[model samples]
Target: MPEHSDLGLLVLPEAVCLAEALCDLDWRRYVAMVELNFDLTQFYDHVAHRLGQPRMFARSIAWNRDGDPLRRWVMAHCGRHKQTRNQYWDRVRRHQLPLVHSGR
Candidate 1:
Protein backbone atom coordinates (compact mmCIF):
# COMPACT_ATOMS: atom_id res chain seq x y z
CA MET A 1 0.00 0.00 0.00
CA PRO A 2 1.10 3.55 -0.79
CA GLU A 3 1.65 5.94 2.13
CA HIS A 4 0.10 9.37 2.26
CA SER A 5 2.97 11.58 3.33
CA ASP A 6 0.77 14.65 3.30
CA LEU A 7 -1.42 13.34 6.09
CA GLY A 8 -0.59 14.08 9.73
CA LEU A 9 -1.70 12.35 12.90
CA LEU A 10 -1.57 12.89 16.68
CA VAL A 11 -2.23 10.74 19.71
CA LEU A 12 -2.34 11.22 23.50
CA PRO A 13 -1.72 7.93 25.28
CA GLU A 14 1.40 7.36 23.21
CA ALA A 15 2.84 10.73 24.16
CA VAL A 16 1.74 10.27 27.75
CA CYS A 17 3.18 6.78 27.86
CA LEU A 18 6.40 7.99 26.24
CA ALA A 19 6.81 10.77 28.77
CA GLU A 20 6.04 8.35 31.55
CA ALA A 21 8.61 5.97 30.10
CA LEU A 22 11.17 8.74 30.09
CA CYS A 23 10.42 9.24 33.75
CA ASP A 24 10.91 5.55 34.35
CA LEU A 25 14.17 5.69 32.43
CA ASP A 26 15.62 8.38 34.69
CA TRP A 27 13.48 8.31 37.82
CA ARG A 28 16.24 9.66 40.01
CA ARG A 29 17.51 12.31 37.58
CA TYR A 30 16.55 15.87 38.38
CA VAL A 31 15.61 16.47 34.73
CA ALA A 32 13.30 13.43 34.78
CA MET A 33 11.65 14.47 38.04
CA VAL A 34 10.35 17.98 38.81
CA GLU A 35 12.07 19.80 35.95
CA LEU A 36 10.35 17.60 33.35
CA ASN A 37 6.92 19.08 34.21
CA PHE A 38 4.42 16.84 32.39
CA ASP A 39 0.97 18.42 32.56
CA LEU A 40 -1.96 19.55 30.42
CA THR A 41 -0.08 22.75 29.62
CA GLN A 42 2.87 20.76 28.34
CA PHE A 43 0.52 18.34 26.63
CA TYR A 44 -1.08 21.14 24.71
CA ASP A 45 2.36 22.27 23.63
CA HIS A 46 3.20 18.77 22.46
CA VAL A 47 -0.11 17.36 21.12
CA ALA A 48 -1.99 20.63 20.48
CA HIS A 49 -5.18 19.71 22.31
CA ARG A 50 -7.44 21.56 24.72
CA LEU A 51 -7.75 19.51 27.90
CA GLY A 52 -10.30 21.37 29.96
CA GLN A 53 -10.36 19.84 33.45
CA PRO A 54 -9.12 17.16 35.83
CA ARG A 55 -5.55 17.72 34.73
CA MET A 56 -4.40 15.81 37.78
CA PHE A 57 -5.98 12.60 36.57
CA ALA A 58 -5.27 13.31 32.91
CA ARG A 59 -1.59 13.84 33.64
CA SER A 60 0.48 11.00 35.01
CA ILE A 61 2.30 11.79 38.27
CA ALA A 62 5.61 10.39 37.17
CA TRP A 63 7.48 13.57 37.97
CA ASN A 64 6.17 13.92 41.49
CA ARG A 65 6.57 10.20 42.04
CA ASP A 66 10.28 10.48 41.25
CA GLY A 67 11.03 14.07 42.22
CA ASP A 68 12.58 15.24 45.47
CA PRO A 69 10.52 13.78 48.28
CA LEU A 70 12.01 16.18 50.83
CA ARG A 71 10.58 19.15 48.94
CA ARG A 72 6.95 20.02 48.27
CA TRP A 73 7.56 20.93 44.59
CA VAL A 74 7.26 24.46 45.88
CA MET A 75 9.46 26.78 47.81
CA ALA A 76 10.22 25.44 51.28
CA HIS A 77 12.27 28.50 52.28
CA CYS A 78 9.86 30.00 54.80
CA GLY A 79 7.32 30.92 52.11
CA ARG A 80 9.80 33.12 50.38
CA HIS A 81 8.62 32.30 46.91
CA LYS A 82 5.86 30.46 45.07
CA GLN A 83 5.90 27.73 42.44
CA THR A 84 4.10 27.60 39.08
CA ARG A 85 1.54 25.10 40.41
CA ASN A 86 0.93 27.41 43.37
CA GLN A 87 0.19 30.26 41.02
CA TYR A 88 -2.13 28.05 38.95
CA TRP A 89 -3.99 26.91 42.08
CA ASP A 90 -4.31 30.49 43.26
CA ARG A 91 -5.87 31.45 39.96
CA VAL A 92 -8.18 28.44 40.17
CA ARG A 93 -9.21 29.39 43.71
CA ARG A 94 -9.82 32.96 42.63
CA HIS A 95 -12.05 31.65 39.85
CA GLN A 96 -13.61 28.88 42.04
CA LEU A 97 -12.64 25.96 39.80
CA PRO A 98 -13.24 23.55 42.75
CA LEU A 99 -10.79 20.87 41.72
CA VAL A 100 -10.99 19.35 45.18
CA HIS A 101 -14.75 19.47 45.67
CA SER A 102 -16.10 16.92 48.14
CA GLY A 103 -19.14 14.83 47.39
CA ARG A 104 -21.91 16.32 49.49
Candidate 2:
Protein backbone atom coordinates (compact mmCIF):
# COMPACT_ATOMS: atom_id res chain seq x y z
CA MET A 1 0.00 0.00 0.00
CA PRO A 2 1.08 3.58 -0.68
CA GLU A 3 1.79 5.77 2.29
CA HIS A 4 -0.81 8.48 2.94
CA SER A 5 -2.41 7.76 -0.41
CA ASP A 6 -4.84 5.28 -1.86
CA LEU A 7 -3.19 5.03 -5.23
CA GLY A 8 -0.62 2.28 -5.65
CA LEU A 9 1.25 0.77 -8.53
CA LEU A 10 0.68 -2.87 -9.33
CA VAL A 11 3.26 -3.71 -12.00
CA LEU A 12 2.54 -7.15 -13.24
CA PRO A 13 4.47 -8.62 -16.12
CA GLU A 14 1.98 -10.12 -18.54
CA ALA A 15 -0.29 -9.39 -15.55
CA VAL A 16 1.08 -11.75 -12.87
CA CYS A 17 2.19 -11.48 -9.24
CA LEU A 18 5.72 -12.75 -8.42
CA ALA A 19 6.03 -12.82 -4.63
CA GLU A 20 4.59 -16.18 -3.52
CA ALA A 21 7.29 -17.91 -5.48
CA LEU A 22 9.98 -15.94 -3.71
CA CYS A 23 10.91 -18.87 -1.48
CA ASP A 24 9.44 -21.73 -3.43
CA LEU A 25 11.18 -21.66 -6.79
CA ASP A 26 14.58 -20.82 -8.15
CA TRP A 27 14.36 -17.48 -9.91
CA ARG A 28 17.21 -18.17 -12.35
CA ARG A 29 14.72 -18.16 -15.19
CA TYR A 30 13.10 -14.83 -14.49
CA VAL A 31 15.74 -12.41 -15.67
CA ALA A 32 13.29 -9.58 -16.24
CA MET A 33 12.38 -8.80 -12.68
CA VAL A 34 12.70 -5.60 -10.66
CA GLU A 35 13.20 -6.45 -7.00
CA LEU A 36 13.61 -3.97 -4.20
CA ASN A 37 15.67 -4.44 -1.02
CA PHE A 38 15.19 -7.70 0.82
CA ASP A 39 15.01 -6.34 4.36
CA LEU A 40 12.66 -4.84 6.93
CA THR A 41 13.18 -1.08 6.70
CA GLN A 42 13.46 -1.40 2.96
CA PHE A 43 10.15 -3.19 2.90
CA TYR A 44 8.44 -0.35 4.75
CA ASP A 45 10.32 2.14 2.61
CA HIS A 46 9.08 0.57 -0.61
CA VAL A 47 5.54 0.83 0.62
CA ALA A 48 6.01 4.31 2.05
CA HIS A 49 7.59 5.62 -1.13
CA ARG A 50 4.74 4.54 -3.29
CA LEU A 51 1.94 6.98 -4.07
CA GLY A 52 -0.62 4.87 -2.20
CA GLN A 53 -1.15 1.48 -0.68
CA PRO A 54 -0.14 -1.41 -2.88
CA ARG A 55 -3.44 -3.18 -3.24
CA MET A 56 -1.72 -5.72 -5.43
CA PHE A 57 1.83 -6.91 -6.01
CA ALA A 58 3.49 -6.03 -9.28
CA ARG A 59 6.68 -6.91 -11.06
CA SER A 60 8.64 -4.37 -13.01
CA ILE A 61 10.13 -6.19 -15.95
CA ALA A 62 13.81 -6.67 -15.27
CA TRP A 63 14.23 -8.76 -18.39
CA ASN A 64 15.39 -7.15 -21.55
CA ARG A 65 13.38 -7.59 -24.69
CA ASP A 66 16.16 -9.86 -25.88
CA GLY A 67 16.03 -12.07 -22.79
CA ASP A 68 14.79 -15.41 -23.90
CA PRO A 69 12.57 -17.68 -21.80
CA LEU A 70 14.19 -21.06 -22.53
CA ARG A 71 11.11 -23.17 -22.04
CA ARG A 72 7.50 -23.01 -23.20
CA TRP A 73 6.56 -24.24 -19.71
CA VAL A 74 8.08 -21.10 -18.26
CA MET A 75 5.75 -18.99 -20.34
CA ALA A 76 2.85 -21.19 -19.33
CA HIS A 77 3.70 -20.82 -15.66
CA CYS A 78 3.66 -17.07 -16.10
CA GLY A 79 0.13 -17.30 -17.41
CA ARG A 80 -0.95 -19.27 -14.35
CA HIS A 81 0.85 -16.74 -12.22
CA LYS A 82 -1.35 -14.02 -13.65
CA GLN A 83 -4.48 -15.85 -12.70
CA THR A 84 -3.19 -16.37 -9.18
CA ARG A 85 -2.40 -12.68 -8.89
CA ASN A 86 -5.89 -11.64 -9.84
CA GLN A 87 -7.21 -13.78 -7.02
CA TYR A 88 -4.81 -12.08 -4.65
CA TRP A 89 -6.15 -8.72 -5.70
CA ASP A 90 -9.64 -9.82 -4.97
CA ARG A 91 -8.60 -10.89 -1.49
CA VAL A 92 -6.93 -7.56 -0.83
CA ARG A 93 -10.05 -5.69 -1.85
CA ARG A 94 -11.86 -7.36 0.99
CA HIS A 95 -9.51 -5.89 3.53
CA GLN A 96 -8.55 -2.40 4.67
CA LEU A 97 -4.92 -2.36 5.73
CA PRO A 98 -2.32 -3.57 3.28
CA LEU A 99 -0.56 -6.86 3.87
CA VAL A 100 3.17 -7.39 3.91
CA HIS A 101 4.52 -6.99 0.41
CA SER A 102 6.84 -9.97 0.20
CA GLY A 103 10.37 -9.22 -0.92
CA ARG A 104 13.08 -10.56 -3.21
Report backbone clashes per prediction: 0, 8
What is the number of residue pairs that collide in model 2? 8
- Model 1, 2-101: lDDT tens digits are 6776657766875575455334433323222233244223432222222333555334332345544222322232143236546755776679864676
The superposed Cα distance between candidate 2 and the true structure at residue 91, in angstroms, equals 1.1
Ten-residue region with minimum lDDT total, candidate 1: 69-78
**TM-score to true structure, per model:** 0.20, 0.27
Which digits, one per residue and each the tens of the lDDT, describe model 2 over residues 1-104?
65686667867642222233322244522322212222222322333234343423212212223433322333445555665556665666768676688795
Determine which window of 10 residues in candidate 2 has minimal summed lDDT: 31-40
lDDT for every model? 0.40, 0.38
TM-score of candidate 1 relative to the true fold: 0.20
Residue 89 error, candidate 2, Å:
1.8
Backbone clash pairs for candidate 1 read none
- Candidate 2 stretches with Cα past 4 Å from truth are 1-61, 70-75, 97-104
